[model samples]
Target: MATETASREPRTKTRTTASPTVGAAVVKRTRTVAVRLTDAEEAAWIAAALVDGHRQLGAWVRERAVAGYLGKVRPKAGGGGLSPEDAAEVAALRQEMTKWGNNLNQVAKAINSGQVPPVMAEHLEKGWLNRCGQALARMADRLDALDDQG
Candidate 1:
């Protein structure tokens, strides 16, 4: 006597392999998620990444996603990769330098056009030039300090 056989489908298993560690933590990125974004959505993501001081869009996206999932708040990104306090100080120095440069230019123009005496122009140029140089020095120092800390 012969018996009847039942038909069965083959089953395949999905793999979740661990990837290499990124940064200071040993993160095993075992799964991949695919997302489809419209042009406007991609542009918005890029802008947000730039605003967050992130050079890598993927990293920024992952960070935002994880933060959102975990309900965490991150810092702002308005200082060209600098802290808020450092950025503010740098901005103030930049404004001061700009003002000094303008003053020096005006002094030079006055001297050239014979609107001011030679002695007065000399004094004004020297003062403004000194202020500009000081501001530049401060900016450099601040950047150097930031680099050191970073």
Candidate 2:
């Protein structure tokens, strides 16, 4: 009778194997990059990252590195690579811009400090406008040169 009752009981099934397709769509990150930094360098990088409001130092470094690379490799507007001559011209233009900026700052300071009479201020304003016009002309010439090269 015990054997009959045991035979009448239901059998239980067990699953011991995992499905092979369970994680098919998931990608594993296997690549890694390693860098050695001095204590001061690490601190400086961490400080900069924090100042930029980045939660992760590695992310900050990666973003900066990618940006720098893109800036160097990106082509100019006229579809030509940046040659040495182009680089020199750019540097000269930057210097000119800095000089003009300083001149404008001085003019503003003089005007604000009441160091110049109204008539003199008018003359200074005209001169500043002329300087700006000249800078624009120079930039136009450079653009023409670039057009010819392209």
Candidate 3:
């Protein structure tokens, strides 16, 4: 024998999403991917995705998901029209991203472990995430604008 609970509610079917004016619309999904992760790899990816205040992950994942979507990457050696100032700025952005990644991881651990006290890590984490997101978006746009494919 089986038992069921009844609710006074109407059921509805889902409809499709609308397309954008300028570009084609994409359907959102909830499909799952299967991967075999060892302890080390799991830990590493978590660190990577959550690092630096959970800001860079979006950009990082986007870049990986769509090749060349962020536009031209740095020029190779012997590449011409490469300005030193631009190169230096890009390098600095990378460094900034790294710093943010580390800070994010620290904050995540604090929140997870319920330890690392004397520190309300969430506030700083949120601030850094906002800063990193702005910086990342700008840098990606700049890189795209340069069209610096080498």
Best by lDDT: 1
- Candidate 1, superposed: residue stretches over 4 Å from native: 1-80, 117-122, 125-128, 147-150
lDDT ranking, high to low: 1, 2, 3
What is the Cα-based TM-score of model 2? 0.36
Q: Where in model 3 is the C-alpha error above 4 Å? A: 1-78, 116-118, 122-128, 147-150
Q: What does candidate 2's lDDT look like per residue over 46-128, in tens digits?
A: 54554444436666666677768886332233443345455445445545667777877777787799797687678776785
Instruction: Between candidates 2 and 3, name the one with more favorable lDDT.
Output: 2
Model 1 lDDT, full chain set: 0.62
What C-alpha lDDT do the candidate models reach, one value each?
0.62, 0.56, 0.50
**Which residue pairs overlap in candidate 3's backbone?**
52-100, 52-101, 53-104
Residue-wise lDDT of candidate 1 within 1-150, one digit each (tens)?
Answer: 223333353224333243345786665544445566764565556556655777567777778988999987567554456554554454455456577778777877887887997776667667756766777788778767865653
Residue 28 C-alpha lDDT in model 2: 33
lDDT of 1 at 93: 52
Root-mean-square deviation of Cα positions for candidate 2 versus the true structure, in angstroms: 23.9
Stretches of candidate 2 exceeding 4 Å from the true structure: 1-80, 117-129, 143-150
